[model samples]
Target: MKVALFGLGYVGCVSAGCFARAGHDVYGVDVNPVKVEILRSGKSPIVEKDVGELIAAAVEAGRLHATTSASEAVHATQVSLICVGTPSHPNGSLDLRYIYRVAEEIGAALRHRDAYHVVVIRSTVMPGTAAEVARILETQTGRKQGEGFGVVVNPEFLREGSAVSDFVEPPFTLLGGEHERALDVVAQLYADVDAPIVRAETRVAEMVKYANNVYHAAKITFANEVGNVCKALGIDSHKVMEIFCMDEKLNVSAAYLKPGFAFGGSCLPKDLRALTFRAKDLDIPVPMLESLIASNALQIRRVVDQLLRWKARKLGFLGLSFKGGTDDLRESPIVEVVETMIGKGYDVRIYDANVSLARLFGANKEYIEKEIPHIERLMCKTMDEVLEHADVIVIGNRSSEFAAALGRLRPEQRALDLVRLLDEPPESERYEGICW
Candidate 1:
C-alpha cells in the first residue's frame, strides 16, 4: 500500500519510516522545504532513537519519498494520514488550522480522481474533530463523504524516544470509522502487526488519547506528591509505591477504573480522609488528595439533582450499602442518596437482602440503631415490595438480582442505573445509565 503523511514533523517522520519498514510505500508531505529535502535525501528530518536508521534503510530500499506538495503525495498513495500538529492557543483551545488545511488539501486532491480514498486522522484531537474534517472534505471535493472518501480517527500512541518500538508494538490498534470498506483497507495495512484491533465509534477513538494522557499526568503527580510526603517523614516512597503497584487485583489493574457513581466504602472514603488529614497536619499540601472528598460530595449532589428532575415521589432503591452483598452502611453513597431523598419528601423503599438480614445482629443493626433510626422505616421486606410501590427504580449496586429486575419494570416506571447492571444497556426504553 502507498501511504501519504501530511506532516514531516516528529509523527510524520516516524510514521513514514515505520510504515515503509513494514513493506508499505510511504510518502511524507510538509510545508517546510528543509524537512522535505532532508527526507527526500534519505536522511531523517527529526532526531530520535532508531528512526534515522529506519528512514535511511527505507529510503535506500526505494520505499520512502517526501514532497512539499500535498497533491503530489496524495496522488501517489492510496491513503493519507493527517500527522500535522494541533498546537494550543493562549486560552488552551486547539489551533486546528493545520488539520483543516491538510483536510482541504486531501479533498482537493481527491476531486480529480473517482477512486475512494481513506483520510486517517492520526493526530490527537478532541471529539467531533473527525466529523469536522469530514465536512471540510465534502465541501471541498463536492462529493459526499462515504461516497468519495472516508475519515478514520487512528490516533498514534508513540512516545518521544521509543516511537519506533511503540509503533512496531503498540498496546492495541484502534481503527475507528463509519465506512466499512475504508476501515477494512486500513485494517489490512496493519495485517502484520501483533496487536488487538479495537473498533469503535470515531468520537471514542479521538477521546482515548486525551484520557490516557490525562491519566498518565495524574499518576505522575500522585507519585510525586506521595514521594514528597515520604521524604518529609523519613520513609522510602519508592519501596511503598513498588509494593503498592504489586496489587494487580485492584491497585494497578482495572479495578475502580470504570466511569460510575461516587466511590464510597468503609475503607476508601475513610482512608482517603485520613491521608489528607495527616498530610495537612504535616504542613504538606496535597490538593489532588484533598479534592477527593469534595469531588465525591459533588457526585452525590449530581445524583440528587438527576433524581430531582424526575418529579416522582415514590423512589425505589435496589441496593443501599456502599457495595452490593454488604450490610456495612458506613460511608455508603447510596445511604446518603436515600437520606437526601427522604429529606426532600420522596417516599423511599430500599430492598437489600444482605442489609435486611444483617439488621438482625450486624453492622446494619448498629447503623440503624445509632446513625439514622429513620432508615428502619425505609427498609422493605422484599424486592417485590419496592417494585410494587415505586415510580422510579434506582440501581445503586451490581447485585446479580438487579440485572434481571430491569426486565420487570412497568411501562410507566423508569430505572436509573449507577453501576452498569449489564455489559450493554438493557432493552428497556425507560432505562438511563448515570454515565455510559
Candidate 2:
C-alpha cells in the first residue's frame, strides 16, 4: 500500500518510518522545507528512541520519501493519512486551522484522482470532525463521500518516548469509517501490527484519545494527592498505593467510572470527608480532593435545575436511598435533591422499596428526620402510587424495578434520570439525562 502522511512532527515521522518498515511505501508531506529535506535525505526530523534509525533504514531501502507536493503524493498513494497538529486555541479550544488546511489540500489533490481514495485522519480531534473532513472533501472534489472518496478516523495511541515500540505493539487498533471499502483499506494497513482491530462508531473513535489522555492525567493527580496526604502523615505513599493497586476488583480498575449522578453511600462520603478534613487540619490543601464534595453537590444542583426548567408541578422519585439494595440514607445526594424540591414548593412523592418510615432506625432514621422533618408523609406505599401522583418521574437510583418504568411512561409524562437505570436512555423526547 502506498501512503501519504501529512505533517512531519513526532507522530508523522514515527508513523512514516514504521509503516515503511512494515513493507508499505510511505511518502511524508509537510510545509516545512527543512523537515521535508531531512526526510528526503534518509534522516528523521524529530528525536525519539528509535525513530531516527528506523527512518534511515526505510529511506535507504527505497520504501520511503518526502516531498512538499500534495498532488504528487496523492497520485502515488491510494490512501492519505492526515497527521497535522491540532494545537489549543487562546480560549483552550482546539485550533483546527492546520487540520482544515491539510483537508483543503487533500480535497484539492483528490480532484484529479479517478480511483476511490481513503482519507484517514490520524490526528486527535473532537467528535464530528470526521464528518467535517468528509464534507470538505466532497465540496472541493465535487464528489460524494462513500462513492468517489471516504474518510476514516484512526486515532494514534503512541506515547512520545516509546512511539516506535507502541506503534509496533499497540494496545488495540481502532478504525471508524462510514464506507466498508475505506474501512477495509485502513484495516489492511495495520494487518502486520499485532493488536486487536476494533470497529467503532466514527464519533466514539474520535473521542477515544481524549478519554485516554484525561484518564491518564487524572490518575497522575490522584496519585500525587495521595502521596501528599501520606507525606503529611509520615507514611510511605508508594507502599500504600502498591497495596491499593492490588485490588483489581475496585481500585485501579473500572469500578466507579460512569456518567451519572453524584456518588453517595455510608462509607464513601464519610471516608472522603474524613480524609479531606484531615488534610485541612494538617495545613495541606489538596484541591483535587477538596473539590470532590463540591463537585458532588453541583451534580445535585444540576438535577434540581433540570427539574425546575421543566416547570413540572408534581415530581416523583423512584428510589430514595443513596444506592440500590441498601436502606442507608446517611449523606445520600438524592435525599438532598428531594429536600430542595420540596422546599421550593414542588409537590414531591418518593418510593423506595428498601426504605420504610416505620422501620427507620439509628443514624439513618435520625439523619432523614433532620433533613426532612416530615419524612413519613413524603414516602409512598408503591411505585404506582408515586407515578400516578406526579407528572414528572425522577429516576434517582439504579434499581431493577425502575428499569422498565421509562418504557411504560405515557406520551405526556416526562422522566429525569439522575441514574441511568436503563441500559440506554429511552427514545422518547420526554426522557432527559442528568449528564450524558
Off-target runs (Cα >4 Å) in candidate 1 are: 427-429
lDDT of 1 at 112: 89
TM-score of 1: 0.97
Q: Find the 10 residues in a row with the least total lDDT in model 1.
A: 361-370
Candidate 2: tens digits of C-alpha lDDT, residues 49-149: 99999999999999998999888898899999999999999899998888888888989998988988999999999998888898899999998998778
Q: What's each prediction's TM-score? A: 0.97, 0.96
lDDT of 2: 0.89
What is the overall TM-score of model 2 with all chains considered together? 0.96
- Model 1 over residues 59-107: C-alpha lDDT tens digits? 9999998889999988998899999999999999989999999998999
